[model samples]
Target: MSDGDEPAVTGEEVRNVADLARVDLNDEEVETFAEQFEAVLADFETLDEVPEIESEPDLVNVMRADEVEAGLTQEEALSNASETEDGYFKGPRVS
Candidate 1:
């Protein structure tokens, strides 16, 4: 989409975003960030118009050898617990 056709980012929009994110923003900060966000979105729009790239290597999941390793014993694991019952750490029960 052309830059002129793109929706303009405004302070009200920024404030709405901040409210949705549970953030507090003063009027001045909102105004400043609205301008910054508009610039960033314009840059992203420009990038979106570039030709599709295919030179990158295909993504592959890197794996490691599966092996069993020695680990902490049950007693050793529970040793630091403030409370334990029947070989397991005891915690407050949820209602």
Candidate 2:
């Protein structure tokens, strides 16, 4: 339950969990997984020692100010199109 303590998971518990998850486990696998689970949980307990810090990040306006700009005319825009209908790019029917 805590760091530096033996993992409390048992083979029976592992077997029960495996059964619930529809996983087939033999006695050997159950024993192996019980030990593995304990080691994993013990590793997780070490995370408790990580120092907590402010969650907020530095706030800054990194974006450039918005400005109106000249855009391509309809003729220039449609010039590259493989197909155009009524001054608009024509795509294939979807339905």
Best by TM-score: 2
**Candidate 1's residue-wise lDDT over 1-95, tens digit each?**
23676447977899999999999999899988888898898799899899987797887878987899999999999989999999999999989
> Worst ten-residue run, lDDT, model 2?
1-10
lDDT of 2 by residue, 16-48 (tens): 999999999998999899888987887888787
* Runs of candidate 1 exceeding 4 Å displacement: 1-7, 56-95
Those runs of model 2 whose alpha carbons end farther than 4 Å from true positions after fitting are 1-7, 53-57, 73-75, 85-95
User: Would you estimate the TM-scores of all the predictions?
Assistant: 0.49, 0.65
What's the residue-level lDDT of 3 in candidate 2? 50
> Candidate 1: lDDT over CA atoms?
0.87
